[model samples]
Target: MSAPEIYEDGCPICKERLENGSDVVQIRQKGADGINAASVQRGDNVDVAAGCKAWLNEKFAPDLLETKQDVVDNMMLHLQNMDENLHKGHVGEPKSTIHQLELERLRFVLTSYLRSRLRKIEAYFPHLLDQQRNQTAEDPLRLSPDEYIFAEEYANNMSLYFRRVALRHMPTAQQKLDLSKTVAPPDLDAFVFLQVKDRQERVLIEEATDDQEEYVIDLEENSKHLMRYKPIAPLVSNGAVQLI
Candidate 1:
């Protein structure tokens, strides 16, 4: 038996007004597929895009595998202990609030990592995946043989993202620009105030230009101050500070 069809006229993509009522086709579903919560909040300071770029570059240089993996693993495992402590006596996999929070923390680390690589894929091959490319393949940067196809495919999938990033070409300036173009890198250039969620020591001063200064700022609980958004990206990424 065929079920009765219900018709609702509107744009399917965004649910706004339809440009042409007769041209659009609407599909009717049997059941609702909505969730109570759809998105997860990761910290602001954690620069996954930066992490991604580092990982990709390291991949090309096989000798640094051990050193790179250690740094990456340490960052991801930072929250796993708390996650385990929160689920100490469970026989089955725990689905408690603490477990969810821990999962989110790990997710943030991975999300940032992947995002950073995509940023590189964009810069290194700015026009490779474009539908209407302004630059040629030889004009832009080239990825290694192992990375070329993957970077192109990944960049294609994240096309819309390239549009939203505020400063796309800035990061590639560090590289030889005869070929490199920064694609949709996450911007960490903003200067702003932040409030410390907990007591933190040795926070890098936002205004310091020299990395060799041995300068570190301490923040007491609930303390607020001006800082560069990038220096505190790790803190924000891990939920240590609140934007003010």
Candidate 2:
């Protein structure tokens, strides 16, 4: 048997009347003959869309929730040890309180990461402008960035961001020979890339030089033991590292 259907209707931001434009989202049971016997579709506004639709997984899906719960579980394991040491009494520190605090901290970190990535993605990938626009309309609180416009709008409220990075690009044999002679190929350019995560993050410091321009790429250490990237091709070609 199919589950009962539900609907949620709200006035569009521009609509004071009953219907300026109404978005209809419905949840209906798939017929027995349907390929998937059990499935649901909800509206774009729904935390979980009830229907089969593209962007459903990205916008509203339970898979990420499951993964987040796994992270919370791992956090609790370390929090447990802290609690044992903090409370020396026979009645150990309250496990539930510690768990809740740890979960809250994890959620804050995850949300911040997602917001930063969403802004960067929107800035670099112009093709997503339409989707971002629709999302901003539906959810006014969504973190969408207008990099050019927002800079001026929030100019007084913003702080300058500066980074120093070290990057080494693997060069072709011929390019290496030119670089060795203090000459670099015209097509080659250098840039530093940083990836951020909970404990495991990478930082690269790089120097980019053009005929008339020289720039430094800034890299920071948020956590300890940043991985060192060996220049494999250059090292091998220059007989610095023996290749098997």
- Evaluate all candidate structures by whole-model CA lDDT and list the values in order: 0.46, 0.28
Candidate 1 lDDT, 106-217, residue by residue in tens: 5665655445544555554544334224536544223333345776566555554553453365566542332224444334565666778878988776445656555687
- lDDT digits (tens) for residues 83-120 of candidate 2: 55335433433333333443354345445534443444
lDDT score of residue 104 within candidate 2? 52
- Model 2 earns a TM-score of 0.21
RMSD of 2: 23.0
**Which segments of model 2 are wrong by more than 4 Å?**
1-93, 127-244
